[model samples]
Target: MKNYWSRWMFVPALIFLFSSCGPSAHIEKDKSVDFSRYKTFAWVDKDGEGRKDRNNRNDITESNIRTAVNKQLQKAGFEETKRRPDILLSYDLLVERSTVQNNDPVYSQPFTRAFYSPYYRRYFFVNYPSQFIGYDRSERSIKEGTVTISMIDARSGKTVWQGWATDEVSSRNLTSKEIDAVVRSIFKKADLAKR
Candidate 1:
């Protein structure tokens, strides 16, 4: 009886293993920048709501987003500033708590198929245990993400260039490494555009 069940679970397991196979990201681009003479920058946290916690409007600012932005920008050869800069930069983080469902319809197919051979029926019946029960579940967690600078004209304060990227990072807290990875990727796009 136990052996009969394992056969049923083989396909679903295989289906799940193959289905979850890529990165989670979506980026939007703006291509109206006068890329020349826009190397200097000055920025600040403009969104008060971004710095405030959703619950109390006071518990936000876990990581200094501005500093992280500076790190990435400087690494790209843009100079920092105090007064008016050719570009003004600002950034904000967005955390969303949600559930991700796990589903693998073909996960159990292979195991079941192996057991069904003409000469192996009895062998499978004797050795295999209960099948994996189909219980589609969800992982509940948070998605913390960042939105970087939307370049503005220093003379007119009008946004001209912008790039964005997001990754589903682990939810303990935002790490500098994680932020750097995503930001660096977006900066690469800017560099590519320069060429």
Candidate 2:
């Protein structure tokens, strides 16, 4: 019985810990555009230059993001082409620090305490009244990172699909696998391959 009760109590804590760490993504796409028609894609220059530009301030981070996006797109049956492709894929990264505040309601509970009357020299119980305690507010600053991937129609130069994945930045930079997972999650939610 004790073991079962302990297990039940631990489940919620475990769930909360895991839920707080997972990455989330939001995807938006033009419903009118048929994604199935897009069979090939090419990377768009960050500065809209004729030639491929490596002007991204963080070369390593950009490389990792590009590699991960390429892998996910290829997995979805999109081929990278140099010639005029069906869609132009572009990605951007943003990192910023923000303060998050949590306001927890504080409540006071009624309680009974044993007291001794000095004159009577006897022990007596007194009821402590319950009252509303204000709120316990705490602020924490966190570094947040966002990766936005957009697909533009090569001919029209209009965005057809976009995905944004944001999460707390754990380190100075994210590893290749981490980037891959984030991109994959975004793509998975988009369901790009489905007709």
For candidate 2, the C-alpha RMSD (Å) to the true structure equals: 5.1
Candidate 1 ranges with C-alpha deviation above 4 Å: 1-30, 45-64, 107-144, 192-195
TM-score of each: 0.58, 0.70
Off by over 4 Å in 2: 1-21, 47-56, 107-134
List lDDT for all candidates, in order. 0.60, 0.82
Query: How well is each residue in 12-98 modelled by candidate 1, as lDDT tens digits?
Result: 888988545322334443455556667788875445553355532122333445556677677777888887788886554554565
Clashes of each: 18, 0
lDDT of 1: 0.60
